[model samples]
Target: MTQELKVINFMGIRKYTSGFSIILTILAVASIVFQGFKLGLDFTGGTQLEVQFDRPADLAKIREVLEEKQLHSPVAVTFGSDADVMIRTQDQMSIKGREYIAAEIARLGNGASLQDVIRPTREQEGFVDVLVINNLTPDQVAQSGLFDTTRFGKTIVATKDNTTQIAIEKGLDLVYSQHLLKELEVATGASIKLRSSDSVGPQIGDELRDSGGLGMLCAFALVFLYVAVQFQWKFSVGALVGLIHVTIVTLACFTFFQWDFDLNVLAAIIALIGYSINDTIVIFDRIRENFRKLRAVDPIEIVNISMTQTLGRSIMTHVTVFLVMAVLYVFGGELLAGFSKAMMIGVVFGCYSSIYIAANATVAMGISKEDLMPRPKDETEGGADLTP
Candidate 1:
């Protein structure tokens, strides 16, 4: 008679020991220490400067230009290799920066002069200040006039205070801001300072981080409860073990690379949990079926049999799913690239955990005779049915 094929017979290892699980757990802990996960500006709240030029620009050049203005190097990303560039600059709202902006504007153009170069920042109304410097002492004036004005027959008048003022068109010196500060210095003969216009608050990022952790906890606990209720306690325990194992491994990979952890990473984690559970369920279903089919078989051998039967299907399904995720990673654009990457890694490891970790855990979980055997038929004297 032909024998049932042992799918793992060709495979080198069939079981995962406690030692392997312990070692992986240690690695996962160390991951947190060495590779400190950094939050992205998206959840944290930072200024996002979008520059769309007529032509494609290199990131390196863009950074160099921005740094010359004293602006910190922005997190630069291009959407789908598009011509436009997105720059995330450091946050700055200090009085020092605003003070510097005023000084920088004054020295914008050497021969061209600040008046000629610095256009009004406001788009619609122009500011014309009519300061009566002759009548007032420096301390006498409470504040400088911020002239918001329009033109009259003879001269320009302040719209806000009705004071006479000068006309400065907006968007005049802004183009110079787009240029390298070095070029600005060379052309305008002024020392340009990089002013921080925006920064993300720690409160927002901290909230996200806190919520992400909570989300993970909630996700795992709920899943464990459901699986436990649906299957046996042992099945649920093993599934959770497999889950923790794969999650740690995936997180270790993330730490190893020092990739930025953000909302997207959390999304990936949730998705991974779902994906891994599906694999676990598939294997568990097979085991339940095998138990009924081979009631006489030992639990260890039965588990091995179940794993063999489902191996082909698991590999085929995960491979096809992985192929699609790979495509998404390659072409889904920068926004979703990290998410796709995490999913691909999860699929591979989740499959591994199901066969090796989950099955062995079932073995470790002691099985009673009743667990292996079906209930005996009730006789006329049902009480005596306990006889073996």
Candidate 2:
């Protein structure tokens, strides 16, 4: 049951579609400039704090408490999620702060319950630089058994009678005391202690940013060269044009949503270049074949017919890829959210540009009936370049 497919007569757009693309490119650039991006902690260093509670917690009051401690304007993210409280502050982590945290939660009656500190900026390089040397004022060890020593960070043991000692450096910055400690105990169902330093440096972020950008440029250039060699320069022009379209569209989506431009996004964009060029190649192959059959048609006519013939296939491929990307967007963890979003956007626009954009540029190269049509077998009147 091979049904005959009618060739869609698209009247076909003129070859000079580059002007339209220029407009789209302008929009993307404008978006990039006026609306900056919301960079993630991975690219920009910041502190992320996760605290759990037996009951719903109020962040406004918690921020107020931190404000009283000289740390104001903390970015809090808590919508009943595992990592509810994420604070991006300019202040650095330090020692002797654990006591202050514990005292404030109890004094303010804030039911923070449990707390875990993550210094994405510092921790990327190494742990904290500060240290905490606690010298407890006790005969030996304060086993009040009442102080719920398990809830406290730690108690110092002395060789002599009741005396005291204290020093501070940083490690973990985690404190187990008061309500915060109790909630931590209930949450983890285990005794916990704050030890070791957690810190991040700018060097790792800078290196990642540099490598990602460099890799994308190198990959794109290599792909452009390969396509140019495989097809004629005009066909390569189409493929490269489509690739640029996909890249800009994807990047614009990132900027619009304020998603961080990280290595994953960069990798996704590179993958898109390959995907877009592949579709362009499929159309170009069909156009070349049609040029042989329609010996008298303009190159633009062959391009249009080929696109019409391949439209169904293009739709099928992009739809399948889009479905998988949708799954990742919905079910994948936070780590993959950005990557999935980027892929989804690229695939959609990549297909559209492959047909409407890439082919248009090839036609715009002044392809005429003579240049587009396949040459006939050598004849007496044929050009000297052909053999008898």
Candidate 3:
């Protein structure tokens, strides 16, 4: 004989779970208030250099060299492999020198050219002109002071239809990759190559940080309106409370671990809001349905029944999302680490809030069968009096 499935009484322990949720929310808020996030280059404005070496790089030596050069608090970390390293510096002081070094190494290799080693800057289109100077001596390339700033800042003229027009003036700080190379004999020594470089100015970084905050605020407002329209104001309040709980706890994870708060992490938090709201809506819908069907049942029993009915679906949904996030966290590397980690934490709390926070808050706010059902029309006044 098959054994019958038991109905779990989730609301039976609402007193305990609700108290636990309140304490957790307090701790999460306290953690966020006390420990601020460690903002990354995407928010703080910095230079990122992707470099590759012939062999595994000595991270300590790289850090020492960068420190000696007075680069701003440079952080060197390995990327996809041990041979590939990514360095982040608070300022863009030594980028030109690093590019010059890579150009020299490329010229020394047989039949190698500047384009073979040095990658162009992302802002190449902004340059007024580009010219290749291939046959300079090694000594000339080594002297960084020899680069003429006037050439970079000069105005270029173009003629068409017998009329002259001025092209955009180039910035004095623009570094051309083609002009940075020279000719030399190949040597047997190991060398590091510059794979890529990216920089964000401080002004842009501040704007991005502000925009991220605004985006989150907008999300909360939109969610509140949607829930209020779709259900009762009580349901909307529950959903908003649940969303706030998920957001604070997710942010608390970042603050407690001192993880990098970048664009990806911000995106993850927004996504968590959507995911958490979706789960809460499912339970709320079930609760509304039960209110109409079980008119004689107590509100607390209806809530427990609704939660129990959706328990299987909730477990399956969150577990699937959790597994995917776990894979991303483990294999997506440092680039996706912050995003996936935030998602993993959010998934756990998202489930918890849907059950304890959203459902419990709805009950506490006095949801009942009458809220979901329509009132009967008056039958006594159905017809007008003929005497009138």
Candidate 4:
């Protein structure tokens, strides 16, 4: 014998829940429109440095020191651990410097390929441009071109003698990696070892941002097509609305709070679209099944019965997922902070939109038994037919 589920009057308070959803959506839209997002280095194109500290790092003091030294708007935050810090700066190497370095390095030899060039701008002696040249030895590079001159001008060889390592101090006025490392060490009173340094051009960052946005739009359109084929156009619209709700609200939280919106966070939002839609699809499936099974029941009653039956499932799924997201948020470190937070918000609102936003929209659109009824073969060819 099957267990009897307690039918919930889900639609009884639909007005209140619908109003709440509308209010949330409106607030979310307003926040996004006004506050915008705090774009990260990945989107805004800047210099990033990762450093490992001998002890726990003090972010505030580090920022203070950088500011006092006038290091061009440095933003410091703990990365993976208290002992690790990542710093981003608006300071970027001029394209002129990069092109000149690249061209000059290529002139050394046919075998010499320019990999990267980081111009150090610190006032410290022996700190200069770090050139990563592939297929070339340090001695070979040291004996040739700018290196031959900079060697006499007091260039420092900061890396081990290898086929790849080369540093040339042209005594340029720009200050960067070595400068930042010295300042951080003095500020935090810890041995600051440079872990990594990277630079992204503004043009590249803009391209990435545009690609991410286009990817999200494609995701929405594909989801609409999927739901339309699997269920019906009415359910498809509802699913789309639900997805938009989760996305906008998630973005709103980030925008209003001024959280860093980077490529990682964008990826999380895309992942959220799938997760939120799964819940919506589950409810839609149940509603379709009940519409067929309970021929005598009204649409509202059918929805309530379906929701009541799936309540246990929805609760279990959301709780399990939420627990996982909580762990990630707490322990996944600063690099994934935005991603995990976005996921956590998605899981919460995913459940809500699936029930209140998606399902309610379908119901309010006057969904009935006939809309989900089995269709003839010709009709089915043109539309969805859930006939078993």
Candidate 5:
């Protein structure tokens, strides 16, 4: 008598596991729909100011001070250390900049009149504001050396129709930054120094957001095509669903917890897709191999054997990656917090998804030995095999 083959029946709880996955997916989708995401400056477009205090900064007090100064809805967080703080605020028009530009144009003595200073809108980009001049052409204004002063950031001269518009770049820093620095200094009284300052326009932010989303979509499509070609369409369907599940659930964690969703986090999510699909492919390959070799075994038994064989490898890989990500989350500072957090979440779900979501999906799709077996050559059509 042949010795009996032994394997853990991972699919024995298929109904329970499938229900759990479905429930989690629903909850994730609901959280994302209702709560949305707390977008960061990289996506929403805003001014970011990093300041260092001589002493440890009081984050709450800093927020209060900002409120007192009428800078509502400002986000203040501790950056690298307690003494350093990063502040982000929405778009702000620079009144002082407009006034300075107007005076400079008048002093140019070119009979140029400052018609209007229009603040940048979402539709317009690469400029803080459009300075409509009545008399001077864009080239004339540019050559006047009015904006050549170091006080301004960068200037661009352009003409739309007959009107000359002088658009200034690197906005919100010339005026708003100075005012913010002064107010923060007086309020904190800790001798704060502005370490860095940057601004991103709404148009640029929109473009980044769109591009990030497009990148994710392309990743999913490519993954599907690859799996379909390498394995069967059934395995590809399972892999695609597994990827979508992992991505959505990870994003839902961010939305529910209100973490800063920025470019770094977006990159982490894309990276996670690759990692998750890799594990799925490994398990799928094993399943395909076992299905072809274990001809006498049942479909479920073959899957169980495949999973049991790869369990140790999967555990080792995921644990190693998880530990690295955990270290990154703890010590990588605020800059990499979002990235590491996203990665950690992905590792956990990526493993689970490969086992249950992807594998179980293939099983549910009625995968069989014949599905993964190599097709026999049509000897009858190939000249009767041409054998003796």
Candidate 6:
């Protein structure tokens, strides 16, 4: 004879767990209200420049250089590797100033081309912001006596039409490459390259912040509608409660830790809503099934039985997801740190909300067998009736 499977009394303990859930909800709300998120460059609006060097860069020296140039509040930090650095500044440099800086970097490297330094923005006429290449060796360029300095002006100017002509006359090559910044590292022994650059305006940042919030609201609204249509209103309400709980708690963690809230983090929050709703719907479906099958059992007992039946599945699913998120958090690097951190937090809270918040909410809203049963058709309604 097989031993009987024991039904865990999950609903029986709801009284205690519900209180804990309420306390957690309150604390999460308080944290979010009191301490706001640490917004990232995507939502704060600033200039970011990524550079790579052949060798590890001296962060302090880089910072000092920016300071000397009067860049306001310039921040330089190591990226994935010591040779890779990302710099953020409140001020955006002018095209002429950028070209001058490129020249300075080329001098530091030994020799570099204009194409190896500044990023070009092509206009209908030609490349508007052209970098002038000093073909002279570092030593010759350093002498500052070979040519008329006044003719070159402060920055190198070149149009698409004259670029090849200028290169031929100057005994230099006019070309373009994504890794022009890397050439700087080769020329002067400083071995630096410009990887990428981005600049965001303050107004654009504000718009992004507002749009992110609106996107989250839209996601929740859609979730509520989907669940309500697929299941009963009570089930939809329970799932919505669970989703809200998970979102609030996740955001609260961000606020409490003062983590950078960016577009990636926003994406993670939307994903959390989907994950939490899926888990809630699974449990809700099981409850509805048990309600119909266990005719003699009380509604509370049926709920407990349903939770017990699905507990193993829930555990396995959450554990698998947690492992993947853990790997991402540990190895995805600083660029993906915010996304992985938010995902990890969401996974944990999503599991908790599905079990405690969603299930308990259904009970509080007075879910019963009748809620899942089909309503009787009205006798007066016109329909084909067949007697077999």
Q: Give the alpha-carbon lDDT of every model.
A: 0.61, 0.60, 0.74, 0.81, 0.83, 0.72
Best-to-worst order by TM-score is 4, 5, 6, 3, 1, 2
Among all candidates shown, the one with the greatest lDDT: 5
Per-candidate TM-scores read 0.67, 0.64, 0.69, 0.73, 0.72, 0.70
Candidate 2's residue-wise lDDT over 146-173, tens digit each? 2233333343322222222211122434
lDDT of 5: 0.83
Error of model 4, residue 256, in angstroms:
1.1
In candidate 3, what are the lDDT values of residues 1-388, reduced to their tens digit?
9766465678788899888988988998888889987888887787787777788867777766667556555677888798888877766533554455346435554432332212234444454433233333434433543334443444333333333222323421234222211110012133666688677888888999999999999999999999988888899999999999999999998999888888999999999999999999999999898899989989998888888889999999999999999999998866688899999999999999999899889989998787888668777667866785
Candidate 5 global Cα RMSD: 8.7
RMSD of each: 9.2, 9.3, 10.4, 11.0, 8.7, 9.0
Specify the highest-TM-score model's number. Answer: 4
Q: Is candidate 3 or candidate 5 better by lDDT?
A: 5
What would you estimate as the lDDT of candidate 1?
0.61
Error of 4 at 45 (Å): 1.1
List the lowest-lDDT window of 10 residues for candidate 6: 165-174
Which runs of model 2 end up more than 4 angstroms from their true locations? Answer: 1-4, 9-20, 46-169, 172-200, 368-388
Query: How big is the positional error of residue 205 in model 2, measured in Å on the Cα after superposition?
Result: 1.2
> lDDT, candidate 2, residue 61?
55
Model 3 Cα RMSD, 1 decimal? 10.4
Stretches of model 6 off by over 4 angstroms after superposition: 56-189, 377-388
Error of 2 at 147 (Å): 15
Model 4 segments more than 4 A misplaced: 1-3, 52-85, 93-174, 376-388
